[model samples]
Target chain A: MKRGIAGSLESNDALITVKESDKLEITIKSVVYDFFHKQIEKTIRDTLSELGIDKISVVCEDKGALDFTVRARLITAVKRMEASK
Target chain B: MRRSLLFIPGNNPAMLRNSDVFESDAVIYDLEDAVSVTEKDAARELVSGFLNCAGALPMEVIVRINGLDTEYFSADLEAVVSDKIDSVMLPKASAAYLAELDFLLTEQEKKKGLKKRINVVPIVELASSVLQIDEIVKCPRVNGVLLGAEDLSGDIEVMRTKKGNEILYPRMKLAYACAAYKIDAIDTPFTDVNDGAGLEEDCRFVANLGFNAKAAIHPNQVPVINSIFVPAQKSIEWALRVQEAARQASLKGLGVFSLDGKMVDKPVILRAENIIKKARKYNLI
Candidate 1:
């Protein structure tokens, strides 16, 4: 299983972890989960779809990360995962 | 020149969002020591993304790229060499290092088709760099020097004092070089963020030595540095008085003029004129 990580658990940042999987799967745990869970998931999905990445499981440990932050972390994680392979 | 340049970690999304809120004269998104090696790529991506979307920042924007010696230097340049940034702060700055950076910056400018070249503010921290400060400052695209006493102290095996006594010689040497070269001399940050009085004392000490500005690590230090570096209203009034007195003396064919029972001459008038000029530039008048 190839796994890659990016970002931090600091305030307004996300600790993004991506692992090899059978299909695209995302799990989000956010400090602002009550309000932004959907938005965060949508961001991850949009980013993965845009990058045309598949067969990866993305776990976004988000700490109130904005749209850009979420996208950046996901992209960085994807790149790191690719580099490891 | 900016009175204060606030250093913000490139990887922090929160800080990046509120960077301009502090009202510092400039903001330096740092891609160097503040970032961990593992996260260098993340920071680079975040910084470039932020600058791309953060359109038209009110104050001057700068990026402190990794030094030329590092493997990330090229990528750092590729990420940050944009029109949004007015300058880039190069760490571990030396004559040789600056020569390499100058060539690279020229190439970057050409690649981007930038009509205006990016300016460089080199960090004068290493022992070897202090000796070659003149050569570094005289290098192409060099605009200013920020004396990083923390690294300089460590480099020279000296105790870094809050009073900044140990780095006095480096301070003076850097100030002299910058003054001669007509560039800004920015003092390093006072690391103790809670000690406002100590921060003021350090600012005054360096300002008296002809340093025009200082770098701040925290938002609180911004106001403190600006208060001392910016001309006070009283000084502006006094400068106007001296200016009027000089005009009167010139009209009367008297080389010397009196301002509040004190004899004022060429140098005195020039100093007052500078104060007024700076005030005007800062819109303080």
Candidate 2:
């Protein structure tokens, strides 16, 4: 069974959805997409690497959140997915 | 010199980012009461990362971690014991916990290669902590005591009041203990954010009761609290006069002298000097 989605969707925040997958896939939808798309993607990848998480599909919807906030939401989502295991 | 210590929820990144804008004397990144249990780890990581990367904020940065007995305490300490933090606010503090935390902090400082010692301010919330205020304040790494009125009221089975009559005794006891130890005594946050009038009144009351600072929960409360706690113009003038008189007396080889017909001794001179120092800090002189 797939783990449930988690994280916040508040303003200046991000909502992260994590699900079990055969291979790792990361997607991002951000309000400041044109300006910070690459940086956001790098932050998500870096956070996942630090946590040693793979084989999971991650979706992040950002609303102008900073790198720390993005990393925090991703970590929380991963923890939630792990807890449901 | 902590006129105001504002509590920012650790889980809220936006608040943490905008914390310095409030210009509070200290900003407490709270991992204790503000964060939910499930989000504790994420909050700790976010706070630590932000502190490490954030360069030279205008205010002091403090982290309120879980109590020593909690399962999350060790992890919280591990995440937060960095050079970026000015102090650790220990919730539900007691003498025993303070001693243990002192040891833990030393170990963390050494392992992290932190050049300066991180100070600890104990929050007196439980009835047991209030009773042991003297011992708690005397702990080596202790820098101050902060009153936690909401938790304390719950512990004592008393209703918290806007006038704060129920907590008077405990507040006085904690304040006196801090004064005896020459450490800071911080009053609890006024929970009614909408009632600016009531908050101002409470700040004045606590300031009169010898509290050196008050914790604020909102940005709007910061300026009001800071203004109330700063020495008044008349008081600053009086302090300057007393300071000059004491200087003259000392030069004349006199330890005691009369100022406005009141005997000025060591304690009086010390109080005057403190007032003047505070005035200088606030740019009043």
Candidate 3:
């Protein structure tokens, strides 16, 4: 029911998109997939869970964003989605 | 000795990451006017998380939250209150607002078990607050006062000019009140970011008017503001000589001394000591 995009494609940032869905689904694309892949996924999941969001689809294109930046982009995308609805 | 306080938007990660590199005396992570209504929560979370992770920042970290009149005030405080923050910049500040903020900050400190008390710096932006400047600075947790020229000018129905003719009275009132209270008086930012000459002139004018520091909307203005507020090399040398002479006089059981054939009193000695202290703090000595 809701869809939004937050963040930029610039370095040290993450381009995130969120859409309403029946169940949680996440897809991440990043250059540092080998070393930081799990950490990045956990950050996204933790942020969504903190916001009381469970049914959503997220696509994160990361450019070496830290945990805080990832959380910020994800929360922004979720807020945008909620507002759209 | 805050020569410059740079304002960084809370929602922008790039800006926040690069904040520590600017070398400003203080960096204000702005969550009030800079952050939109919808992204308030996101910005708060980001700032809180970033502060929590930042081990030891080179400069002071101040968080500027929304005013007490807004619903976001409580949440903003909750999100940003932490041991990492050196101070909280309260926008549109007044006596009542500062009192409430002091109470809330105390509660937050207790809740978080913070070892040190966080200071609150008031921003006098409204005409009503400007009228209550004396009372506002007298609040419990206020360590400094910053003039918000844009909002103050708007409130008084005057256009903000680069010449800064309209807001002179309010600026002077705030500076005088802060001086009486022995607190820092910070001037507003020069809005035109591209005008280097104008920024230098404005900084000199405010610094000469007894302002302790000036705010910067951009990082590039930080160096200019710092240079203008810092004591000149010749003045530093003069202060050093005066201090040394005073020390020798004190050892000789004298309350006054002659420096460069001019009578130097206790007040003059104190001024020289203060100048040297500022110079040392800024690494100019």
What is each candidate's DockQ, to 2 decimals? 0.69, 0.57, 0.52
Off by over 4 Å in 1: A33-38, A49-55, B250-256, B261-263
Sort the predicted structures by DockQ, highest score first: 1, 2, 3
Candidate 1 chain B minimal-lDDT segment of 10 residues: B46-55
Per-model C-alpha lDDT, please?
0.91, 0.89, 0.91
Estimate candidate 3's RMSD in Å. 2.3
Model 3 C-alpha lDDT per residue in residues B1-285, reported as the tens digit of each score: 588999999978888888999989999999998989876877787788789878889998999999999998998899888889999999999899899999999999999999889999999999999999999989997889999999999999999999999989888999899989989999999999999999999988988888989999999899999998989999899999998998899999999889889999999998898899999998898
- Candidate 2 steric clashes: 0
Candidate 1, residue B255: Cα displacement in angstroms equals 5.8
The C-alpha interface RMSD of every prediction is 1.0, 2.0, 2.1
lDDT of 2 by residue, B1-285 (tens): 689999999988789889889989999999999989877877887788778778888988899999999999999999999888889999999999998999999999999999889999999999999999989989987888899999999999999999999899988998899889889999999999999999999988998899989999999999999999988989888888988998899899999999999998998878778888898998888
lDDT of 2 at B124: 96
| Cα DockQ of the candidate 2 complex | 0.57
The A-chain TM-scores of all the candidates are 0.95, 0.90, 0.96
